[model samples]
Target: MALNTIIINTTTTTTTNNNNNKEDKELNSITHFFCAMKQQSPRRRRAALTTFFNTMPYTIDESQVLVMSSLWSMAMTNPTNPELPFSGALHCMSLLINKSLSQPSWLLLHQNIYIPYYAAHIIGSYTIKSSSLAELAVDAGAVPLLLELLRGRLSWVEQRVAARALGHLASYDSTFHAVALHGEEVINLAMKISTSCLKTVYTEFILSEDRKKYHCDLLTRGLGGKEMEDRKAEEWASQLQCWSLYLLSCFAFKDKGCHYLICRELGFLRELCRMWGGMVNGESPAGVGLMRILCRSSVGREAMAGCPEVVLSLCNLSRSSDDWQYMGIDCLVLLLKDLKTRIKVMNMALDCLVDLVELKNLGTRYNVGSTITKALLMDYHDHDKINSVVYRLWELKVERKRREGMMVEEELVKRWSLGEAKKKEGNERFYSGEIEEALLLYTQALELCPLKRRKERMIMYSNRAQCCLLLQDADKAVSDATRALCLSSPANSHCKSLWRRSQAYDMKGMAKESLMDCIMFVNLLVGENREKKKRKVIKVPYYAARMINKQMNAVGLFAGVVTGEGINMQTIEEEEEEGRRRRRWIKEG
Candidate 1:
């Protein structure tokens, strides 16, 4: 189904230490309120959050909110560029949502704010008042995108946010009927994550009202008279926080929420098996056992004790690659942490590690071994398996690390010996007047040295370049000099190497190539933003370097913006809800 894009007139700003100003400080002050609420319990957190929203600082301005909204939009769409402002906005949402079991309500709030925003973002641009003031997301292609996200638990943050957003859509209508992506393809692709096939509480919500949040800067605050995208983002975020906290409430208090989740969302676990594709055992038609138990449990638990099955299931597909295994592991880890469900998924990780070792893929074994080692070290007080698995994990990790360290040490020793021999050979070749042979020997020696000897390598690279120049190997000469320039640490060494290479390339009738290399030398390594004229015979090309400066600057800015969004968007729901409530009341009045 197509979702309507709601263009809000909200405003916000973030302060990067490097980009600090008066405005940044004030914006941070406003966000600090949310940050403080992060420490509160579910009930107190909500109360504190509500109080904070009610007593919002009067100095808050519209332009600031607009900026923040633009930043968020940029981050979401700027997945490629990375500088887009809202890029790490999900992190903000996670902070608001991923609370302790004690704060289930706040967690629900966190879930709602980001999920709806994600749904809306997928909606694309909208038309309002016959004048498109801003672009709002639509739901034209969100299903496929969300399915893709579920295919691998950790493919893309944007996609993960979108998938989680589906749950919120289901909740928005207060029905919890739609088990999103409960279809065959989505289920089969997702290793651990599941979607329900039959009627669930969210099913009603998904198919219910299709109301568009029509936000305008000039309009009154309400459904149609929604606040500006920039202004109300934080408020809408607050509303989402409320919903997520509510959902989280389903998990705590020793209730049957866990088992009911599996049963109420009928065929969810089955779809998970189906989505696992090649990894599935294909036994018993995907959760025939789960079906009977879930049906029995959901019906029986509420009437009986009410405590749900707190344990979840996990898989370990040893034949799969790191990416594939990571998908499953991430889901398990997340479920364990967020759902307060203890699952016996560590067996899968152990199986994967054991298989990795058995396959004799040293690199992969080392990688998996390292991963389990970290897991073993993590605080395991909550998990029962850690008692049985920790020692084994430690034993394996020690063995792998020992072997790896030995291998590294042996390689270094071998390189050192080889380098010594090569250096001797180079001296002999140089004394014999065989410059080409001498250069080859030097190159061999340089390649054998450790990173600590990078300065020596730079010198050798320079000499090789000189030899190549004499031999009329302009390409080789340029390559050697360019590499040397890159490795050269001292200011004088870089200046000389870059100058030599630039001149040598020009002499070889390769001005364009030389220009490109010279440009890279300055911009990437030397960072030659300015130059002072001197009586030197040669100089690095300043114009070429200048040409790429904007691109690099843009990349740096985008990175900063993305990182900031990650930091600021932790409680996206709280911000959004706070905005929505104020707007709604104004509209009603």
Candidate 2:
């Protein structure tokens, strides 16, 4: 009997006959059709199954679940077979879309775990091939059933299919309520699966999610306990993680989904950090892509500040050569937009920017630009996101130079303030003859100092050198003095650092080194005096005459220099006179 004939009788004879008897007859008819379907050959079955669904009744009465359940069982039993009635079942659901019948179909599919798995298989295989059908299936309430399939300890195959299907559904429309409802769960599952799969294959080290983070600890740490299981298990777990990440990434693309992701319970953001912490794992791209999506929103970016390692993980990935650098920059740019919100975040961003610029200068200064710079130049179309970040970092660097006397940028000033307080305490200790204590304070100041405050850092280093000289550690004094001199700009180079290094060299009996440093120090002071006089004479173009003035100062300073067994270093009185003259010139000018 045709499915419609049985459906007509079941609806019409509801009171004439017992409802159970009518449902049984309708189920038997559906059963007979399925049995006949199994008997047909592969080509016959495909055509017969297609025709059977096309002719089936669209109405889903209360007793319709019995027939739908039977069809779901048949599909599950022959899940891998290409000749099965997969398309028939999907077509039946598609016809039920947006009708009172659709909810019943989904209810039956969700009644048992097996049905959801079956539905996911059909979706993963068929719906993915057709957008209209995928949308149709989702509209017919496939998402809830698919999400149900993801729950619990289902087989890897079932979970993979469910995740893939949901990914397709979510990708089609990110703002789907289904995506937002379970976005956090999906992120957690993806992170859990990704970490598990990574450990199974590599088993190198167990990662710690503690906030007491060490620099590059994620990269260097090792996990060395159990040997990995079979490669097949690893492969299956990897696929599950990958699909789950893809699904979660789809969820992250929308504002509500992104908000749910970062603010979820059990630290979903921390899990993301752990997944992206080490070397580029299999889930890195998906993880980075999700981060990129989250960065598109202020709520998402604000939530990210709670996970401190997120910034560190991004910094680590930015140093890598993979495409993750692109996503990492996207994330960092968003975080840097409002630096006043989180001091720790601002510090981490500054650290990353400095590392990126320094990394680009590793081989040669001018040959290759930094990773962030290259991305900004080559991917300018993405400028609103990428270039703004790179430009802001460069602008900060330039501002750092301009504000040599006074710390600029509120965040930089905040960092410098703490360092300056420590330096002041160190200065007091040094004046009171607490040489060792003063050295300790100076070292602590260096830790608190911002990298952008080059002048302040140089002063701290020079202070430590003075203490080192008092402690009779000539080598340490020389090291500190040289660092201060190198850190200083050409225009504001610290003559005291050069004089201290000269003293250290004299104590070490290196007469030539002492003479050279003393001569350089004297020239630096004398050149400043000459610059003052020249400024009074006429406003000279400094850039045009810079090299010429440097040469002239070199010639004048060396004429008084004599390298011998006895080195005549500049006296303290001479240094005081030079300082007083410079101060007087400043007041006179």
Candidate 3:
């Protein structure tokens, strides 16, 4: 019988009077659907199944035992009828995959490809919401059939739904064992699919100009052309990888042995860290979700700690604004909580963790950023150790800024020009003896400058340091100079900022620090002169040489011994006066 005849028969049997309630009509449709399934005609049964599958709600009630059993039989058993003995959905799926090279006609392709996908989908959907339903599906032998599809007996399209069904089945304690019986094969296949599904889909469907008619129709749902096919291909590809990871996570969460298998394949973990799933499906956790599951095990944490690339990828993800950003942080925290892994991965994670210290509004945990920072740092009793990590973080941040500055986007260029104009005005004000006004202009310019303009921002910071120095704010001067030095391409290589910080440290009576900065400043001056003169001979600037000599004398190893206790007030006053004279002389020259 034709499909239309079957549909007409179903409508005739299920038709209700206008007075009938919606519940009555739905009940009638269910009754007629089962009646159609019992018919000997293959076309009638197939048509009825398609209609029922399409209209079924996501939540299947317990009262629908017969409906669930029928779907499982269709999915798992070869048809007993001699007319179509090989026409069971799973059997046909395998046959179609095996004989796909012969290039079947469009109708055969559509039936074979779509029936298996829908049968697996219905099984998964009904089981996902209730463990009882999942148990029933497991008893009906859904795992082996689903496993066939997952093994790529068909294309990635079928593997997508197969993985989803198996994941749902594996999630329940009652049904997990059935799935775990083939745990090794299941995990290995899931990992393989997750790692290569994207490329597989692209090669089979999206990249093929002469795509099969059924594939194009299925991808676009017969509504569009190549563009729609491409869109659907990417979406399905993402689903394939995500659902595969979801399956692996089920095993990794329940079994420790699974963690060893998963983490042992470090390449897969690295791939997982890069699967952000947002481009195709925003809500899918992709690889980060799996990484979080793996982090829950000691074996997994050690494996991740051993792979630098995977740890680096997590660090990158934690610092991003991606939706799974917290999961990345969670994984890192788990690793850090382990003493053995902490020592190995702490340095790489420090930069990202330090950046997150000020993060806010992270999914209802408003203070999580600061809380995590405090907890991580609590292990370090020595303040110096904490300071050293923070110092290294600053250097990493500055290098990142310098690298980003090389891009020079259009909007940033405009902002940088505005900052330059402000800096020019500040210089004019300072030359005119309007020291306070110059200070304010430089502050505004610093705010206006884009973070990407590292070189320009370095100059702004150095100028602010000078203003702070003359305003008698020694601490602020040191801070600004340090920022300027960090922003320099090679840290501590900015001559002016080094000299200004040296002066600020000298004012604070930090003789050792002051002496170090003065020597660095003198060395930079000599290097610059050698570069300009193109000569082997070195000649430091007169001002730098003088500053270096003063610092050397002030910080002499025997100075305190000779004076019986450091320089006296009059000598300090003379040094300050000479500093002022030296500054004026350099400016005049």
Candidate 4:
């Protein structure tokens, strides 16, 4: 027994030593990579950078201050500029991208483009989670070099990383001034890039299929092919715009001059409304997030009020189940709260605000939507019109309650029982391949269900939506799903209804709407799993991920115009107007 115990202790010691050795080897490799970066030979540096780029993503260590310093020096200092501080040795590499490049020239071009990108990326990654590391990066002169990349020194790919790094650096109070030194130029560059980056990427990389040879090698790193290149291009393009907006957001409302500059750019405001950042990137508030920031300032509120399209966009966003719906509601509330801009925006906002009188889960305060609507109506100069509008909405609400009422407690219980029985029958029929009979039964169940029994009504509507989907009636499916969503407590939380609506929208070829619903569905699933399991990492089901990817590709920004299937902006506006008209209760009141 003594010998066995001794043997076990020895094995444990051996395993611990092996782990320590492996960790030491990794640390040494990082140091060697920095050493290679300092070498005078271009080939050695390029090889080192490629390895660093591929491996750095998997390795994040905040203890490596030496590695951070070397990266900052490489990222900020131009090798070709001998006068620059910390400049590296200059090599005879051509920076131009050529399709018919000799092997050596291609290697040289690769080094020129990738070194700055990889360097900026490493700096951003290290600084992302640690304010101390961000301070270190700022102290090491990372801001100026990152600014050069943001200026499109190499390509949008570099701009993506540069903006991301600078955004991180600016997020810390200690490092913000390092970025603020070039505040005006940085804000301008970020705005310009945010507005134009998508078009630029689409035109340069996606549209010009012939130019694929130039960057394909770098994009795929020789491990992947065209599909990977395209995917990376799309993701990087999105990051470029998103990171640029993120950088601008860090500066927004902090400086009066910067705030005015952002508001004065009218085209940028319009683009912000349209830049939804796609459904795949659900976490990014994208344009709405920036708009929300701008809304805080007087100038931003006035600027948004002056733009009719922006006001309309906000109204549409406020009424939808999009992830940033509350932000949209906040923007409108800000616009309405400001006495100066209230009149300018009241006419366009009135219709949407009236519809939201019953919105319960939007803001932190109870009945927040009612509070905003009441404020708008009370503050308006045209009291007669406002009074009439309020009366009409109130009348509609009273009538709805009256029609669904007139039942005593016992009657209500009986009806609820009947509704449950009908629902169970419908479910049985649905599973037994009798879709039409199931649809009729669900409709009867909805009729029998008390309106006050919101949960039961929601389930019945969702059941009917599924039947509509099977029947190929997309319009009815959408309506029933939307109704079910409206009845759900906290709004848009019914996962089955959201999924059915998404499929119905897809059948109608409304990629944007479908994508939004799909994303909401996936987010709901993720949120539920996290709460129930108490796990840090949330995994989306495979089928849901696949749906999101498909919808993302279908809803690719600028793809319509690039592929000769562009939508007419005017027609889209007319359709939106028509939708508002349908929901308009106080028209010309």
Which candidate ranks first by TM-score, i.e. highest? 4
Per-candidate local distance difference test: 0.38, 0.55, 0.69, 0.71
Candidate 1 on 180-266: residue-level lDDT in tens?
334333222321222221111122222225322322221223433222432233233222222222222222112344443332222
lDDT of 2 by residue, 1-589 (tens): 6999999887888766777787787676556457557754767767766666665544333444455556555544554444433446664544433232235445444223233344465556555545655555665566666665566343444566678777776776532555556666665565455434443322322232321111122112223222222223334445666677777776666445455434442244554553431121344475667776776765566666656767866764543333345567557756665443345565566544443442322212231224444433333354354435545555544444455536557767776788899999999999999999999999998877876566888899899999999999987787677657646664225788877877786687544345456656666766776787865334333432443344334322111122211112332233455445433543353
> Could you estimate the TM-score for every candidate?
0.23, 0.41, 0.53, 0.63
- The worst-scoring run of ten residues by lDDT in candidate 3 lies at 78-87
Q: Could you give candidate 4's per-residue lDDT for residues 439-463 as a string of tens digits?
A: 9999888777776787888899899
Clashes of each: 84, 3, 0, 0
- Highest lDDT against the true fold, candidate: 4
Off by over 4 Å in 1: 1-119, 122-180, 183-435, 444-452, 461-522, 529-589
Estimate the lDDT of model 1: 0.38
Candidate ranking under TM-score, highest first, comes to: 4, 3, 2, 1
